[model samples]
Target: MLIGDVARRSGVSARMLRHYESLGLVRPTGRTEAGYRAYSSEDIRRIFHVESLRSLGLSLREVGRALDDPGFRPSELVADLIRQTRERIAGEMELLTRLRRIGAAGPADWEDVLQTVALLQGLGAESAGRRQRAALSSGEESPVPVEALVEAVLNETDPNVAGALRWALERSGEGGLTLLAEGLGSPTAEVRKRAVQAITEIPSGEATTLLRNALTNPDLVVRRYAALALGARGVADAVPTLIDMIVEGANDVDAADALSALAADPASADEIATGLVGRLAHGTVEPSARRRLTQALADIPGTTASRALADLSHDEDRAVALTATYIRKLRDAR
Candidate 1:
């Protein structure tokens, strides 16, 4: 059978069949004289198994493992799948609980309820009910007081949900700032992170302070995110901290990102490039750091950075040599 025939028989799309093939999940059994790929009945069975496992949310890697294991037990896999599904339900329930608290003041208007109903109808009542059932089974909270029809605007995974929440918080007046600040201090890391992100979107002075404090979080992941948030906020106060991080942090990737962010400001670019040149001239920085610093210098536009790059053109490091080329481009453009 051709790919299309296998797709028809197994109820998987031909594009998905090709993706499975690329992932090494399936292969054509043979090829015709004209070079058309062929598949066997066995391939159809394999496709069915792949599709079934996919429907259970098993990743391609997990499905591949199950397919490769001769003694793989479907019952055991199904049990694990059920466990994962339950965990997901529990998480959704927690989100729903938070959403309910936020939306407890009642719908913004009748249109809100109408929109929620429309969304639920679009998703289909049966499918939405199944999700609610899963949430209930996992002991998660509903987004709204109504357990049966929790408004998803507050609990949705869509990016728009964050924006919507921020708008609601702002419109809530003074209480909204307090609520957002409280959320920032929430024990839940996700809530804290989201709160910070949402606050930054509100264009308040407190938001800048919150992001600055987040940059010093014990968690490197959180710090990186905070750095990114600060950059997005474009707070001039953040530039010094970002430059310090680039100079002192062991996490080169994060440091590089911070440096890139700081370099966006012309004053910051001059300061960092000048400081790097001084460090390189004094032999105070390591070769790798020097190389990174040179790269940073090349990132800044203007005569100062270009001149610094021109001075380092004869450096022994290949990275420094490459940076000199980049600097030359800047100078040439002038």
Candidate 2:
């Protein structure tokens, strides 16, 4: 068969066959009587072999070594090809993600597109300061897709940058809530904590609903964050968790303040006071927890809290009694 026939049959072009010959990858050892290049059956088979190797991402040089070298081990070369292919795929995937985020931004023009690109780059920058600036300016300058902000927020390790990303996400409105919700379910504890913290700052009804749902999260950290946010929002659902925080001595001070905030309402105040009193009365309540509980009741009004404090003022434990007595004095002064 002539080179043309081989090219037609094997899909390697005639010019490429000659290039392969020049590179010693494939050469026709047979010639037609009229001095045209003639490819024997073996040369044609070699051409197919070269094309097959090239399909596996081998360079022409590698292909020559693979086909001609007796010492060439296919395992190493195949492994190298696999690594190169994976790297190429990773690069393509990164580009695809960037394009998707940019498209989601809905840039109105080329300038908007450029700005969005810049902001996205900044979000991924190695410098924390640059990332923070990008996050701070994301919603104000060019609209970054909420998903990008959420991704940055979830992955951010720097506290300042994370705060800025959370701010940016909050300013982006409830658009990132679904992504944040997904983050809440992450197996990573830090990610779940970050997700809830970000949701805590979004002052939307949907955000509140998410927090309410997060109250049941199995992660204690997530539950605490949700409860604190709910407490600030005056949601009574956080009452149980806040009381638990006090009893467990985790963020007890903030929990007490939250309880006090909830206590501003007469009905919530009564309920909160009752919960505190109940915890204190439990048989398993430790001396320290009892004292903390007694201290928590100082700001709560109504006869229930005052009566609890009055009773606790004379309790058996000295620290509890002293704390209750001091709180009772403060309450009486108020």
Q: Rate the local accuracy (lDDT) of all candidates.
A: 0.62, 0.92
- Quality of model 1 by C-alpha lDDT: 0.62
The residue-level lDDT of candidate 1 at 150 comes to: 23
Q: How good is model 2 by TM-score?
A: 0.96
List, residue by residue over 74-165, the lDDT tens digit for candidate 1. 89888988999999999999768645543653557767555444433432234545444333322112122223222322233445434544
For all candidates, the clash counts are: 4, 0
Residue 273 C-alpha lDDT in model 2: 93
Give the per-residue Cα lDDT of candidate 1 at 22.
Answer: 94
Instruction: Please list the residue runs of candidate 2 whose C-alpha ends up more than 4 Å from where it truly belongs after superposition.
Output: none
Q: Candidate 2 on 262-308: residue-level lDDT in tens?
A: 99999999999999999999999998899899999989989999999
